[model samples]
Target chain A: MQFNKAMILSIGNELLIGKVLNTNAHWLSGELTKMGFIVDSIVIVKDDVSEIASAFLSAIERKVQLVISTGGLGPTFDDKTVEGLARAFSLPLVLNAEALALVREKYSSRGLPLTPERIKMAYLPLGSKPLDNPAGTAPGVYLKYRGVHFFVLPGPPREVEAVFKTSVQPIIEREFQRIDFYEALLTIKGIPESEFAPFVKDAAERYKSVYVKSHPKGVELGSPVLEIHLITFGIENMSQLRSCFEYILMSAKKLGGEIIVLKEPGVKL
Target chain B: MQFNKAMILSIGNELLIGKVLNTNAHWLSGELTKMGFIVDSIVIVKDDVSEIASAFLSAIERKVQLVISTGGLGPTFDDKTVEGLARAFSLPLVLNAEALALVREKYSSRGLPLTPERIKMAYLPLGSKPLDNPAGTAPGVYLKYRGVHFFVLPGPPREVEAVFKTSVQPIIEREFQRIDFYEALLTIKGIPESEFAPFVKDAAERYKSVYVKSHPKGVELGSPVLEIHLITFGIENMSQLRSCFEYILMSAKKLGGEIIVLKEPGVKL
Candidate 1:
């Protein structure tokens, strides 16, 4: 079974300067992973046009099936995401009629005039459709280039969530089949990572479908706490994922690991 | 004076899978920005050798002065960061004596034998120096290649912080002269982002050294709250940074914006 690959680009100067935490990338990664796309990379770039363009081109070169970029879709001058996307594909930036109507309706409802600053949000790359932003003035953009479907979203967390759920999610659902992605976390103590490392290695080699990773949460020599996360993509069923997880737990038991918290598969933490 | 450019690579499957939130990227971006480096991009890739090599090559192609990668330096099979770096530069991975000694001492202190999994952490790319991990077993790797300084750190947040503070920070201080980077945040209400955007654009143009960005916090038509962040790099003194910030405040006041909060430069939020 072939899995669709996806990439996320988070564009903003606030993100680059560390003034804003990139919760958008994390949120989108979760959404896409649940939808069955293997999120290959999450890149955070500044609001500079060249940087944004280069990032987009790199994603294109990687041949990802889906690309979702959040941020830089505002009215301000620093909102250069669309311009950068246009430059990446050598396409012209045009005033999208649907986007302009959305922007006009949003402002008119608030009894505000369409100033040049407001109209700036209407400009999009050529041959792109506008995704209606239910929460903001700047309409999200949707374009397809070189077989890669791109969804360009706004910077604000509320707006990103709204646009992705309302506009982007449906398209993803229609375009790809959801793979059975199941995972469980085992918070185990009393075994150092160095000693447990062999178990993880052997388990990874044994279970072809499962990916096991050990995150050291506490000191190795003193009170060692390791969060062993087991994940399986494209599993036949939950039982298969569970069996793989159970094997890892049994191995942990051999080394006197006390399981503090066992977050089972399909259970939200 | 030209600002040095830097890039951050956060490599791990956990990050790409959204199992982990990348606070390291944010923290390092803040630290690098405070040290006068222009953080161009932060790229998070999965723990794949080719993906890691490609990310590193892109950073080099951009001519960044410094590059720091966090994660994938461990005693497991998936810890392929050092191997990836070697592949990027066509350099051979060799067991460094210094790194071996450090790893041996770390393990032996706990009365643990030198297993192959434990010994795996000592392999380093040729000519790279090992930065002792004060908080973990895997020693951080430091290499200068083609005019770009690279620091490869481990995954855990505490280890990343400890290694950076003890090993990376001193080298940066000695290599680069500090440049003045001062910033202030002004939280104002009653002015919508579209209405306030023109002033931000003008301020950005007038104060060439200062970067002005506005983040919308509240509804536009309702009680609009916006966070206007003003940043000035290479300023002569704090007074100049203050003057630039004050000018932005004056513009905000002209629009009848009520000042809700003013986070002064050098004040931690």
Candidate 2:
């Protein structure tokens, strides 16, 4: 069977405008892949409620086992991702008491009165828990709808990471099957991608169980370096994975290519 | 009139898997914003033909004037982005003579026989012009369907950027109304984001044309730094833009927060 697949939804207008780099999408995907989840797509939508709701519904309809969203969980008028989730699932937006406490305490600890706008952060779709967000005022969200778990985190990189590690990770471990992830890389130098394509295609056709992909490091035709990346999922034995890696490495050397770097068990490229 | 809007589609499974950072989306959006286009969304999909075709059609249905896609332009099995575009528009995938010339030249210069796989790069959707790709073998493609222009470029960043500058930028300049893009950032230190929210929502309500966003820099509630970002498009003059900028700056100062960094007329954050 294939690996458990997930999807990422990054909600904001800033992302579309390029005001912020989507380090969250990149970071979360890497973590999820390491945790044995196949991230299928990362979709970014505008701040409008309709767009946000549509994106959420589409992910669920696609039946991705896990859906993680970062951003649009703020105290501004534009932060409507939760309300969008509420609309998507036909659940009433209600103040989660536990979430309210976390948010309220964050402000009270700083000796600041929680304004109406600030208190708005406590409202979430019914049947959802407020994830502890030690990093900011807006508490993260955790909910499961139709067997799909959705982890909603804050916008900032630091805030997202903190909430994810402390609140969301444990839930994922309990709910999903964790498989060992492995990757293999062959950094080939002095080959244009055209010539390199035949090798990849052959490997892909030959090794049905392994992924064979090429990443051209430099764009120039005579570039010195390119990356041949391979990954296998749900394989029980490390030796089987290593054999898959060796088969490709040996084939690359047959092309008269110089192998600059090799990660025995593929490290994240 | 509304601001010129654009969308980005990064076609590849590598992007979704976090194997590759979508620096292209960020870089393209920033450049488009600088050229005065309101980038609406960045959608990343797998290399599957149906997904790629569907993503392209969805962007067009959203009425974005310019849709730029990167990736899946190589000669491997997964490189099916062009075939996807052809399916989306119901165009025949035929080899254009000019594209053939470019592909033939690239291989001929190296005294290599153009294999069938190499020749596959020449076949593109009918009625498309091959954009010059000086950096890679697969020539970029440009086509207009139903009043939308699609620029399909290679996966590598340098190749995407190079072809964009040489072939795509001129078309964007000619077809779209380019406005003067300006941004103003007021980096406030020592404020909780809860304390910072009302200011942004109020400014967003007041400045109808400007986008006001607040980013919590540090994780602590009482952290010493926060950033308020503002952007506007199609302002007639710098004074008009400056006036919009002043409204937010003055309000932040009134809150007794220290303005640590001010990017007068915003730079890409």
Candidate 3:
């Protein structure tokens, strides 16, 4: 599906404090980009009501079509994303019967008694749909407030990934029309980014929709092993993206650097 | 020093593609927080010229006083951040004599001949100050563009960290006046996030500067632990930040959760 713009709100203290690796943001961005969505901004805020509310306002101000927030949907005191959402949208946090039932069933299947805190997972913004979280206690909240679709996913990556793939993706696909998008990654070894700039610029000029980027790899000490990525979108036909990829690969190969080509939609050349 | 806002621009394709982990963003954010800077937003974009320029514009729109960018300073085709910065600021990209000498000496010390690509590393935005990399071939650039301080470091995590600490920190300290700031973090274990929301709400209401959050430890599948963090921040008198933290910890402890007090500046208890 194609979205005009999206914003990611990664809600967690571990993300801000360096205690945990935040792979969720990167993974989500890639997924959205591949689905033809332009991620306009990403905000990492501690799971605080004010911060989340402020970020929500900022996202709305930016007019992002979608806002996906991860974390702060758990049963602990620190899980304030739901409350933050209520404040942001001026909606009361209410318990949804379907969500409550789902939580009860989830607890029952796990053979655990549902505590008051556990039941709190069912509470969401008023008039919101609860997306089932197959892997965790918290059910994701899918809400559309003031033209922005908000997806509140659990903090656990497994649960977030599952809920996103199963529930959120379908909703998004239904809401937006699918668009043709393509990305090509050219891993060029032994070339520094500076030397690679002119060639990439030439290629980008030649291909209007194509973009080239260079990244360093190997030894965290900044040893120069560079990877170049060429991305194209909105090809009139499938052959267009492929031809762009071919032209980039040929030029990169002719530059005497080892090149590995990767085509979008699951083709590795 | 207290900064209400900062933005990070991670300029690399490896991060966007999941080829390399973006530890630099996390580490830098953590460091900035510790130094009393609130990291409001982070953008990970490819080494595309227009993308970098647009990202800068976004940061400016947000009114983020401190804008730090990592990557695209090397001598390869993808290393166009310097040029991109020039475009963003409407300045010229010129060969800096000092940067050229540093690049020459760096290659000479390693007994490597300076290639055209290597010489490309000497180019910098007009009136930009070069920050020594200490561990990499590319020196970082520190410049003021349109009243915002920009620190451009290499993409490598280690180099970014070192350059930021040695070069950027002192400059920031000198440029911005110190504002009395105090922060405390309280780590809570075993409590589900939803159950803890009331306490978070109560604390936030009572202490306007306090913020609480929860994060699942080992976010991947099969991870066994979860962490809840209560953070309080205030300018000048730390008593408010401290009182809020203590109250939350005491309440959580009374409710039978494990609480670990973390060391913060100027807090005895």
Candidate 4:
């Protein structure tokens, strides 16, 4: 369980001020979940170096195996995520020649000179490797610290996806064998969430292999709509997952609940 | 600075698994920022009680003045936020009579009986006051522990907004004087973000009252477009804020940058 535990840390002033909606965390969590990792926590901190370092340390203290952080990798003054990582491990920031070459190549192709700000992107914490960013100037970072895999990515949504796909995903795939992950959503109407809660609890308890949770969409007592989500891990229990889902649906229908929609398998909402 | 610092905690299994986008944290952060509180950090943890309690303890340890947590206030077995609060403070979970009355009234109006599942929503941590939820059945919890004001809100977005507006907002208003807060975005094209970073750094340094950060919307070296975000606080520095913004725009224009759009004052993002 500890080996497959992951945490996401999003760092930026924009996020702290609520100017950005932290889509990066959500995207990373979904990706990690699909890869069979249980995302333990998602923490957002300001651009301040101490805060970033403290957050990283706390994740390590909690024994989080994979820690992926986004934002503050730019060439601006406010960009301090790399420095924060260095501070966290008490590692020296050194210019990695390979990273410098990558940065140099990107700017030179554009007929641009390598300024100090541009070169700043080459600095990496000791023993950390740089991941090539296919879509951005700043190279993403990959490090192993205190038995935790740390991937530092860029802020923009597009760049996050690009670096993650090219660099982060491969490393994750190599490190962990993919577990069988399954999830399904059942949308029902006519019954309040409270009334449906007991059935969900009973199904979850009886199955022991499935996790069931209900979300109330419509009013409690008036035109009630509930979304029941069921999930399970492990390859041998696929039948158990289906039966658990069916049991809940049947119970709901018995209690005057009408099935509104059942999401197609492998479709995420 | 500590007097006006706040932190947001979003607790749920769905959020951890990326089933939900955590719009509640973003929305709450925006509201808190508008009220002049510097949102220090936003942390999302699983619905597990120990994790929830640990998050609360960390925020208190950081000396955060206000902590608003949304999610896990429902009839389900996974709704352990209130219990987590009690665990963090070593307080007992007591049946809140006022909250029970609120729940009773809502169910009685719908001609529904008070089942144990519905009654579960009425329990609160000792010494906690229940806030009326206008949009949902479960009432929000407001508590003062270790000199930090904690507002425990429900998961659903509509219910969160309703409880926040009807209950949390007034308490915050009464406790703290609203500071004048202003933010503006400057969208520019043609110059790259790395090229524009120094100018932003210079403007931020030259204008001590202003905070300037750049977001690259377009490619780094090809057709670069950067959105410069400027933020400031206080009522007396309005003129300085204007000059600071003008200085950045003037500098950008001088560097072959085209002003694409300037957001109206008081507009966010």
The regions of model 1 sitting more than 4 angstroms off are A235-240, A266-269, B237-240, B265-269
**Residue B5 error, candidate 3, Å:** 4.6
Which candidate tops TM-score? 4
What is candidate 1's lDDT per residue for B35-90, written digit by digit as tens? 88899989999999998998888878888999999999988889999999999998
In order of TM-score, best first, we have 4, 1, 2, 3
Clashing pairs in 4: none
Best by lDDT: 4
Chain A agreement with the truth for model 1, given as TM-score = 0.96
**A1-269 per-residue lDDT for model 3 (tens digits):** 24468888888766765556788987887787776677776667776798788878877887889989898887766678999998997899898999999888876764656777778889988989999987777889999999889999987788889999999999989986655456666677655555555676677666666655666665312354666666655545345556666775676678776776554523221
Candidate 1 at residue A104, lDDT?
A: 92
Worst 10 residues of 2 chain B by lDDT: B235-244
Taking the tens digit of each residue's C-alpha lDDT, what string does model 2 give over A1-269?
A: 55788999998887988778898999998899888888888899888888888888888777799999999998777789999889988999998889889878877887878787788999999999999887777889998999889899988888889999998889999988888677877788766667777777877776676777887786435554678878877665445557766766776687787786577665443
True contacts kept of each: 0.62, 0.66, 0.42, 0.75
Could you list the iRMS of every candidate?
1.0, 1.7, 4.8, 0.9
Candidate order by decreasing lDDT: 4, 1, 2, 3
Q: Give the TM-score of each candidate.
A: 0.96, 0.95, 0.76, 0.97
Candidate 1 residue-wise lDDT, A1-269, digit = tens: 78899999999988888788999899988888877788999999888899889889988788899999999888788889999999999999999888999989988987999999999999889999999998877899999988899999998989999999999999988887878677888888998888888888887877777778999889886788999888877757466567768878898888888986477876332
